[model samples]
Target: MNKKTLLFTALLVFGILQSGYTPPEEGMFPLSELHKLDLKKAGLKIDQKEIYNPNGTSLVDALVNVGGCTGSFISNEGLIITNHHCAFSAVQLASTPENDYLNKGLVAKSKEEEIEAKGLTCRITDSYEDVSNRVLGAVAQITDPSSRLQLINNTMKNIVNEAEQKDPTIKAEVSEMFIGKTYVLFRYKTILDVRLVYVPNRQIGEFGGETDNWVWPRHTGDFSFMRAYVSKDGKPTKYSKDNVPYTPKKFLKVNANGTDEEDFVFILGYPGRTFRHRPSEFITYQQKFVLPYTSELYDFQNQTMENAGKKDKRIEIKLATRIKRNANVMKNYRGKLQGLRGIDLIGQKKQEDAALAEFINNNVAEKAKYGNLMKDIDELYKVINGDANRDLWLSQIYNSTSLLAVSRNINNFKTALDAQPAAQKQGFFDQNINQVKQALSNSYSSFELDVDKTILKRMLNDAAAFSPQQKVNAVNKITSKGSNSAALIDQFIKHTFELSKLKNQDYVLNILLKNPKSISAYQDALLQLEQDLNKQIAALKPEKDRREGLLNKLMGDYVNVKEKFLKKDFIPDANSTLRLTYGYVRGYWPADATYMKPYTTIKGIIEKGATGNPDFGYPETIKTLWNAKDFGPFAKKDLNDVPVSFLYNMDTTGGNSGSPIMNANGELIGVNFDRAYGATINDYAWNESYSRSIGVDIRYVLWVATKIDKADFLIKEIGIKL
Candidate 1:
């Protein structure tokens, strides 16, 4: 389908889904409501703030932004807990066939036994300090966007320099929210002494297979344990025999008795990102086009990986973790899209925009000041839409790797007759050589020809349909053949003797071989593209300037309308730090025909098991454990051999995995893992009626640690009371 047609169809789908839903009478709650609620009224202790001191810990204490995941310190001595999935990359990189840590989990018996991950360090620098006044003050005086940004950056950097000088270990980072209207300075103490502790087996940790990912009634025990190490002097230090487990000043005690319905709970961790403040048009775009397209891409990848997984055990092992991770993300985006549709998010946004327009009309006399903001924003949206296909084209070309295609491209690069301008030469070098090298590094390790063919077919088709000027270079045709392409790539790489010669091939060939020297070449190419693409985009920006201005005005209007009509206050979705949300533990029905009750028990494991797929298969040990039927009085009849999991109204996103789900009394009851926006996109704008946080019951974690793994010593270290 054409770009416009695809966008329209997506919007139509969103409209149809949203048509039937009614907005909540109370709307969503604002941050103000959090303070008004009585702690006792929500079954929470007033002393929660005293027990779990969020402010006491510096940004360096509880907040960590790693390469792929966020982490927090749990103990004074640096005991850390994060999602198992987050730790998967480190584990995979460190493991070999003889010692596959992913298949069989790992646990360090003592501080000395802990393994230090390479190229992985947890940094917590003192980077944050309030710079809201400085930013807002500058913006108040400046009208030009470029000047405003420069002023804000300069002010923020000055603040950071001052803060960092106070503490050498401190690092400051500025976070922009509401498109730079609000800024938060994050200060952290860099902690580079992180080490692996304990992790659960893949079977128990990732139960119910791909089918249950991002869905309610989840049984995945997605938790991992790690301890922070420091020098003998009790300061953060790198890996060394002299290092010891850093004792935390405070570590949460594991509460064996879990929480019930309507209990007040809170999660303290680094939540990645949320788009709650995005303009309505942008939200509409996501609901209609972006999410579905992403979901399609993920689905393709999953299928390709799964098919290849079956032939080679190694492939299965390598791809299994990635598939599950991507599946959850895909499910999340799909659910968010659906949620956006169901709640008529765009309609609500439009209503809010109208209200804001009225407010501006009544309060502001200068039409020139606010009138064109909405128009400009609309124009910006249109301009962005024109270039949206660029990403799709790029994705297709980057995701494929066929050996023959690479060989042909390499040969072409070697023999290209044209010596273009310096700028053009650099552009080709960056686009063709550098990117391919990076792709090859990651893709070569897990190469599968059949998988490449499937991805290539989709990408090639997409590229072929691209606007003539926007199409990717033509190496795709050569690699379109499955095994035939692989043979060709083999011959090309073998015949090419010198690295210098290989680097000079035409764009297509340079990309295939995964050349090492392409990095420098890519730098040159990138500079060329940046200048060209920027100039092209800059030209279109002015055409839609009027519309873009309108959209911004509309955004303000929507916010005002939401405040007037929607009773529930809308707070910015969680961004790590500490957040408290209260709601009853309840099950949800995702579709009319299916009800996902809140929990998955051990029996479900046996029922879902298949010998062919290890992901779906329950290990013999777990199966035997289930047959034993060692149930205490806690097992309910409704659960009937099924496991009982709880659902809560807590707001969470990607980085919240392994977050401690604590009761009002500050007792740990569950581990926050995933969200249930599998079929809907409600997370983008939480519709309390639907979006719910899914977590593994804390009781299960204790059971697994004490019963399953028999790590009584480690459990005792965490102060688990049975």
Candidate 2:
């Protein structure tokens, strides 16, 4: 509204239009590419080298891949800070009815009290190098699309294998930055001895719950702490009592002073996949098929689990994490559907693609190189869209339940064991059966009969209603055997559970592991159904692989043509790799006559908590502290309340959760958590206006850790006293 601000905004837009280049907000720029941007001009107070210096240690080394999500080492002792949701499974694993660490917050007073986070691993990026020439060069002579893809895969594997062989402590991965265009080899330092340091209760971490998830003006804390450990010699190793806290080469310092609106910020972490560069055909499929299928199915699953949980406390605890994850994704898909429809991203992509096609055809040289690109891509999509419905439904079967997932895995073990030579059969089992047991143990630990029965029943119903051409044979077998569909489903469930004997952990671990062949004698109805579905899936794999191969081969050309038409540097889409996305802390109107501020405070939590909604649940101590005006050093002078979370126009996606969003001075100001609901479209497209990312402000994190959780020791450990 101010004259100076209005003039600056106008000029910025004009410059962007004139240059035909991307703004800083649109792409998750890789660490290697940070130097290409004018960081200081963007209000970055520190040298770009401080963020990522190829020749020496820098802030990039502090970033962590906490499994699927991102985190950062905040202390020399490998104290990692990440989102509560990222550590959901770990907390759930440690929680039980009598000792509910989830409901009641946890803090380790000393290293002795820290509990092992089973199966959790924290990976710190050691370094990354471009391997495009080596990967693509090896497959240049291959003419067949399938053969070329195979060779590319083999070459990438060889590169990773060689890297890991050189250093056994490192875990290496070759990520394709662009399909058939570029590749990067990232080597990571792994820590298996990860342990929980501090975890806020559900009321704090998940404030506003699913009701406010992905919505802006958010007040969710959405943060937790864990630490990584290694052997005494500073080498990566699994959990052991003798292990010591792993000293990181670099770590981020907390900026408890926090930030305000219009402040420049950037985030470095592993962002999940994005399809912004994909052609219209891909966007259309995502909009019409993938999004709908996943959202609706997840909605049904969450509802089923919720209903079951309401009846049994045990079932509630067992399925809590699964439901939370499913519901989060379900709502996110629904938001994407809203964004795609509301913003017309699909329509926008179609227009851009049309222009690209025109550009390709207008020039003789370009036409010769890409004449059939558009048509070939359309044809490929046509085939995919034909079976989109059936294929989507079929893909969900393996992931439908823990039981089915285990069944498929163990079944593979059985198949492999049976295929070995008679002399080597026992040897094979001796080598592989333990792996099967470990997999089954994880599945069986979380397995619940009620939840699986409900999901299975729903899956069968979906399959039964499919078109005649897309019929699921397993469902058909039962439907044909009986006239009443309900009766058949019931009978199938009854016999499957009773006959399988797999519900018994002893039987599954002992008898099944010893002789997988014995499982078939039971002739379980559900197992038989799974076998039938596997056969169908097996029959479909080759055609699927062929289509995928062709698409992969063509996409490189597609990207090349688009770049030529635009005459701009093409930012590669996110693929769960380390990337840096930057922008200012800003706000925008989500709708007509409605503007959302960039920041929220503890006062918002109080107002939402009073609404009697479970999602906005809060502990009584928070109200007590606020009522008494026991504001410590954390309160903001202007607002007279601690800032809870702030919004920024940075490109982020699923795996960016728990990433440290840094201030201009390269200090941790907040932990990136969610995006505005409208910004869910960020995975497909981005704009500075609506594509805002949210972070739990470090001030709120400090206040909660100190006053509420009584974690003064952590305050001291992090070297920030408040």
Candidate 3:
């Protein structure tokens, strides 16, 4: 036998160290398998059927994917509850200097008072079916790696297309589970006419700001309310004043009694990606290169926006959503990196690989078919990661400035003009000219040349410092006009923005409308820069594509064989699919000998009050209530205080924000918003000992609505008997 055969045989021989598995599997499992999980043993007081049922109305009927986060119907009239941050973009969009809803809270006194939330949609899963066998069977005959992937994708596309043909209003998608070893088809009922109902001030919703995000013992309310409207016939429709409130078949009852420590809890939401089963080589590359670089880039972008906003107030509102998104990812990447180091994830992955090799030894068929999977995957990582730095640098350049993006778009427009036949060129130009004009108009709305120039210089410096010598020479050639590095960069920035007609939307639109035959009419310095970067990327493309294809194939094979032979129940990594994860309301120690409680109270808010900063500036309305000790019916008698926020040990990630946290009786208890910093790595590895998800207590949400905001009609609409 050859060397590869010897390694395979060795792993097969050591596969079986033990027969059984450990308790508490660490993934978001499919909702169809609720009966298989021992929920009762973990303190659940209700039957599994109450939580999920395919043929009847159940809790799933109440759940919704709001925007990208999770939410649920809390009232029969389509009252939806999600995280306040999830609704922040809508709040910012609807606000103005005179009616700044973001600073003061938003509440609609009557149905007619509610304003439309443009570009917002809510999706609910109508049904899901396992189609794994059909998918795998169709692709079984293809041996070539790329061909197999193409065939699988084509098959899934056909299935979705056929499903959508039957009902134009419904959306269908095929999601993979177990790393393509299993597949599920989900059908969704989409509601388009969503409206803003209520949102707290920035002081209450984003109480901790960036400083206290992803930390436990939190006091942020972090909750918001919205309503879904449909046509009079109860069908999905666009934003029309004639639309009526949508009455869902099922909605959750808000339980103001709240939860105690160790009580049963579960979350239903659309979770984003998690790579717990990724190989060690990939993890090492991320820890060393990707996370660190991206974190710093995020910081540069945020600072540029902040500095620019100080000079222009209009830019602040226009860029608020972008800033919030960048900040969230910035902090999240930093937390993930720290958590990776804290837990030694790379080392742990190496250990798991050894055990997996041993497990493979027990199955002779798997040994023969999948013996070289991990070895091949690890080898491909070295080849793929070789050009990662160049690719990342180019990505940063393209995204860092609006002018560069516009230049690239204009270049593409010119290319399109050349590619079309003379007879059809006019038609094509007429079709695409307005799109370019619209893009230019939108880009200039938030454009700040100073901010863009600052970011451009930073990216140029970093790219020059990190790129290979050949690429560095190309950059040097571009900057050779000026005497020093700073002077050269400033010269480049000034030349690009000054000579470009693209800065004025009307000028670009007029030029495009006239249909210039050459790049001379619209050419700018950024176009030259784009041309240079494109050449560098093209030179590196062949090897990158080859290595990436091989790695993808190897991973698919490994997952397939592992699923067939592994003794434990296989749960797939999350792919922004609807999933259910159950756990208990609990807390833990951040370090040795320091136990943290699961829940926080109004007392913590009082202690954090009136720091004069927006994050901790407690509103006077709530302050008076606290000073008078006017604990409403929403306060918990057992704790003798009103609950603010609580923690639980459930598995979740980014898209899980605003998911409804429910108790055993299928009642809404709170809203899942953040996770403890220690738990950020739960996306990679769930450490039951330390990982925890944080949520705002539901009673606090009720208190704010009924007392602070005095939204009594809205409260009555939700049937909350306060």
Candidate 4:
């Protein structure tokens, strides 16, 4: 076998082993089968009889179409509430370094004081009508892939255009699922005027630090506040001092006294994405190869950046956020790998594959069309396994640095364009020149350069034996001190500048002037590196196809494997639209010797405090709360001395963040923040036996707001009714 083929085989073997399955048992879900029970039936819940729906709100009312985690009004006036992290970028952009709003947090003292964020918008008004027949009628008989894709896109575009024309204020988007089996056209009324309302300091918001990202038994006050603004006439408008505070028809009231175990809860937000429908082989590939490689890349970046951060305080501050973000993702991927191992995912997948194969055998036409597609997918896995390591190295090094190359290339394009036709030249300059400048202006600084170089060197060294091209280029560029570096960069800048000038566009000039060749080089290098990596990936296709076919055959053979053994129960994710997952609030043991209890109190913060770590340090106010024998009604146990943390088995994911975890009677208990370690893989497949949701008691938010921040007015506005 070639090196790529060998690598593919090795990854397949590793995946099977990591998933805790023997060869024959690979790809089998011993616990349950597909289609035996309805996921909607298992997961959905509605409060139709109630005056208001507690399980979920309308997608329109919640403003689900808005940018990450923003909401809108059911009433004529707009009012929005979203997570703090979701609004961080807008906050950062609006605040100066001197102000550092993120550090101190921000609260609009009144409607007049609220700051309008630039380019900030919240959209609503999606209208979905079934046009399945209209879309598929013409192409129902077409078998060509390109034709099908084009047909789908054309249909979607037409729908979106029609929707946009009906309401000029509305933005439209089209989503396709099940390989065009379903299409949804979403129309949204854009609310461009938004203002900051309230935010808690990083200390309170991200309490657990790197130690408690995805794990439950948790305490993190991950919440933020924002309100919508409208024109004087009460219609959505651009930022203006004249705009009035929007009054929402219905907004969730703050329930100070939180709920206990088995209470119903729900969340509404724009969840980014999930890979629930990915093929079993793809899942296995990610578990064994992709995730591990990516984790290693993050670790390398973290260490390199952290080391640099220590030298310069500013660097430290800048990289601190990046490190934290990367660390969170790294922790998630690690937990995901562990979850895959613990669940024997490969074994279950194999069983499902067998059943699928048997089904295909029974259906001749289905077998002929889908059989090759399955084979191709398996080949894709093998290719992925073969290229995993190179892909990681390139991603960390060349891919990350490709911006530099792109800048250079853009400059070259400008130079070449001078001789081209006027119309084409004007178009090119108008479009490309401005973008180049923006990229350069935002390029990583010199402090970051050292860190990037360190990672690049490490990655190049790893690939030295396998691929000499990168190492050769690195040596030629750095050691030889090639004059072409600066000259080429200058040429790139000049070309872009000239292009911008020719186009007579200020925006074009701004972009070209800001982005230098170094940044462009980084971007170009990434593309080339990816191309090389793909060559390696392409080599493992044949063997991969065979393995995939085998797995499919196995699934078909054991079609009813899961239904025959495991109990018929499964739930879908908490879509912002509506969902209900009923389970008792209980403590869970993640590992053999590690037990995560049901709740964490304020005292736990004091106990876990490290004076040196700003993230973990207790504020003076919290210390006072501890010093005083002031255990309020919400305090549990005689352990005012003991800090509290809670864990419960409730289904939740990204959208569930900031959801109200309520009691059986629908009283607010806690704010959902994250999932326990065992549940991180719930994104892939939920295991009711172990997966749990972690939430911060609503009482904590009250305590922080009243005692720490002393924001009495804001607290009162939340309708605390205390």
**Top candidate, metric TM-score:** 2
**Candidate 4 structure lDDT:** 0.55
Q: Write candidate 3's Cα lDDT for 1-722 as tens digits.
A: 33654564355334322322223757687786676777765556778777788879888899888889999999999999999999987887887877888768799888788888755899999888888888778877766665666677788888899889987778999987656467888899999999998888788888888878887779999999999999999999999999999998899998878887767799888898888767788788888888998888989899889888887667787678778888888888899999999989999888877777777776687678777777777777766577667667776776677777777778778877878988988788879887877776655655667777788888887666664533544467656676576677777778777887666666666754477464435556777787777666777665554554455567767666655656555677888888888887876878987777888888788777746555677778777897777778888776677888998889999889999999988889999999998888877889788889999999888888887888888778777776
Q: Which predicted model would earn the best lDDT?
A: 2
* Poorest lDDT segment (10 consecutive residues) of candidate 3: 13-22
* Candidate 1 segments exceeding 4 Å error: 1-40, 51-77, 118-120, 123-128, 307-311, 315-322, 358-369, 391-461, 468-570, 573-578, 589-597, 610-614, 631-644, 678-680
- Per-prediction TM-score, please? 0.75, 0.96, 0.90, 0.73
The TM-score ranking, best first, is: 2, 3, 1, 4
Q: What is the lDDT of residue 464 in candidate 1?
A: 47
Better of 2 and 3 by TM-score: 2
lDDT of candidate 1 vs native? 0.58
Worst 10 residues of 4 by lDDT: 23-32
Candidate 1: how many backbone clashes? Answer: 86
Q: Give every collision pair in model 3.
A: 12-361, 15-358
Residue-level lDDT tens digits of model 2 in 321-406 = 88888898999999999999998877888899899989989999999988999999999999998888779888887777778877
User: 2 or 4: which has the higher lDDT?
Assistant: 2
